[model samples]
Structures are given as C-alpha cells and as structure tokens.
Target: MELFEMCPVCQRVCDVQTRRMGTFLSVEQLCPHCQFSRLWNSQPIVRSTPAGNLQLSTSVYVNGESFFKLEKVLKAINLQLFEYDTFLRHAKMFIEPAIVSNFKTSQEMMLRRLSEEDKIIPGGDLWADSPGHSERSGSHTTMDLKINNVVDIPLFKSDEVGGSCQMEKEGLERGLALLQEHGCLDDLMALIFDENFVDPAPFKEEILKVTITEDLCAQDERPVKEEVIESFVTQVKTEAF
Candidate 1:
C-alpha cells in the first residue's frame, strides 16, 4: 500500500484509487504535480476473468463447501468476493462438466480392469439424501471388496421411481444394470449388501438366474444371530484379503 501510494517521479504522496472485482483488486496512483499515473492489479486476468475469483469458486465447489458460507466469511473479513450468480455460472460452465468427465474416465478404467478378472466380489450400500423413507434422492455405491476400491455409484431420484421409499430399489437396480452393461456381471461372484437392506427377491428370480449364480446364491441369507452375522462377515473379509 505504501509503495503504491507514492509517486516515483516526484517522490511525493499521490492520490490512490482502488477498484475491486470479486477477489481481485486494482490500484491506481496519480501525482498532481507531475501529472504521472500508474495502475496495478492484485491478480492476472485470464480471458477477461479474474483468476483468483474463478479459483476460489472452483475450490469451494470441488471441496464440497458452501459458497454462501464463504461469502459470509469474506464479508465478515471485509474482503471482496464475486456474487452467487458468478459462482453458479462458473460451476455450470466449467466445474460440473470436468467432474462428470473425470468420473466417466475413472469408472471406465475400473470396469476395464474388472473385465480381466475371473471373479469379482463387490459390497454395495444405498444412502439417501435425507433420513428414512422421505428422502428425495438416493445413491447406491458398490466397492470391490477384494481391493476396497469403489467400482460404481448410481444415483436415483424419488420422483422417477414413484416415491422416495423406492429410491433405494431404483438405485440398486440401476447399479446392477450398469454392471451388466459393462460385462462385469459375468465375473461377479457375490453381490454383498447391508444386512438390513431390502431383500432383492427380484434379482434372485430374474437377474442372477443364469449369470454367476453359484456364489451369489450361497451368500443369499436370512436374518441370523448377531454373532453369526459377525462370524460370516469376518470369514468373507478373510477370504477377500
């Protein structure tokens, strides 16, 4: 601030002007005696967009942070920030597409690796956006139990499945369908699910009939004692390891 407030030509105090755009600051200094002037910016402009502004917006979104909360923090600190509209624009124009593309690439690589395996055992679970059967959306995620790597994640909307209660079923069905499409079902030995998950009667009757049935049928279980469940899980983990 001090350096920018002085004029080099006359070694005197100069009039300083500041313009703020989002996280970027522009400072201009002018000397009345020599009529000398200079301008400086705190950040570089990339294609007419402030680099810091775009960086802050992208970082907040990719890190699962709330822009509204960040805005409040910046305001409390008297720092300059872009508006919500700009943040949304950045997300729509750049961040979301990048995320989607990266996800597809990673999933494709994982599926390709699984295609080479003779047997694959994946553990899956459904998680809802909200508690109980009133959730608006659900995510079904499957992980390779052998490698402990996530294989796939399918998201389902309640409206598409008639009601929120059916979101879990929809997510499960979609995940299975995706695996089938990728030819991973041919190598799938067991499909592990949470003990409390809704029984997949449809899968037993329709999907698993002819495709890798032996191990899956062996794993199909009814409610049992807590100790038994723990023992079975331990056995499965030992085999996987």
Candidate 2:
C-alpha cells in the first residue's frame, strides 16, 4: 500500500491523491495553490522518511543509492485543467434554496422600485402540466410576466392541492392579488393574452372584479394584432360552511 504525498513545496505540505487500478498505480504531486501537478506511475516503492518507512515512487530520488522499480509509471498530465473545473462547476454543488431566494428578493425589489417611478405595465403567462398523465395529478404554474422582473413562486403539485386544474387559475389570481397589494394595479395600461383562454363575457367580468381604474383598454378584435400579455385574476375560494 503506497501512500500519496504533497508537492513537498506547498503552503501546507499535505498528501496528494493517487488513483489505483489493479497492478498499475498512479500518483500525483499537486500544489495546493498554483495547482501544478506531476504524475508518476510505478510498482509500490518502499522508502524511509522522517515520518516512517513508507511506499512511494521508485523514480523519485531519495538518497545516493537509488534502485529502479521493475514496473514503470506513465508520466502524463493534461496541461489544461478542464476536468477539475467541470467537476467543481457541477450543479449538485449549489445550495438551491439560498440561490433562489437571493435572486427572488432582488428581482421583487427592482420591480417595486420601477413601478414607483413609472406606470410599468406587466404581463403574465399561466402554465399547466400533468406529470402523472392524469388531469387530477397534473400541476399548475402561476402567472409569469416576461416583461417586469419575474417573481419566483413555489410550484404546487396537484396532488398536494386537491389535484385540480383550478389551482392554475388560483395561481394567476395570486399574482394579480400581489400586484393589487403593491397598490400598482390601477396603473395597468394594457394586457394581452390568447383568445381561447376563456369566454369574452367572463373575461371582462374577471377584470372588473379587480378593476382599480375605470378605463379598461378595449378595442375591436383585429384580424392580426401584435403579441400582448394576458394579465387576469382568477377567483379565490372563500371558506364557508
């Protein structure tokens, strides 16, 4: 069993790593800082150090009496450190909640600040998906506006919320309620959305329910219209016996 050692010239001399495969053994002398490394391969060479007698590389010079190992170690290490960098950049290394929260708070603050300065118009998209191949088991996403900075809302699995598509509508309502709470709904200029989203009568009704201002931008259905964002609020369930 050969033990790995440090570059011997590191800030804190420590053990370098070795990866072994059967009879073939590989060792590295890696620097803690500059990340320079010298790879060596050889049959386990036993030598004496101040620490104790240990197995190391036969190629490395120790005393005047140097004996060669029957086995030879291949000396090759790629100059580019892509392997090390890719491993370090892996997604699993991230703390998801902290990252999400940090960005979420920053974006919300930015939107609020912008709204205060100008009548910032925002839009929203409602997303729905069923992972389990059942409507009841599907999930719904809240309104996400590509315009103003997006607010991160936690996903609600349908199973957890009575397995209903209605939750998606609720998510839309939740976003509208948020804007209302911020006291910026009255400044809403225009909203654009797909025509099939709902009936025009109910669509107008839903808008009036949360109407903060009298002027609801209305126009004749154009044969061709530029893309507009849909900003709608769904009804919230009231608890009653």
Give per-candidate clash totals: 0, 4
User: Candidate 2: TM-score?
Assistant: 0.36
- Candidate 2 yields a Cα-based lDDT of 0.46
Cα lDDT of model 1 by residue, 1-241, tens digit: 8887778999888999999889899999999989999889999998888888988988999999999999899899988889999999889987899988998899899989877787776567888878987888878888878898887787778898999877767766777677778887763334443433657798778865676547665777756799898999999999999
Worst 10 residues of 1 by lDDT: 187-196
Off by over 4 Å in 2: 1-93, 131-133, 136-148, 159-163, 186-241
> What is the lDDT for 152 in model 1?
76
The Cα error of candidate 2 at residue 228, in Å, is 50
In candidate 2, where is summed lDDT lowest over 10 consecutive residues? 50-59
Give a tens-digit lDDT track for model 2, residues 67-135.
Answer: 222122221331111122322232223324445677778857854764575454445554556433354
Report every candidate's CA lDDT: 0.83, 0.46
RMSD of each: 15.1, 22.9
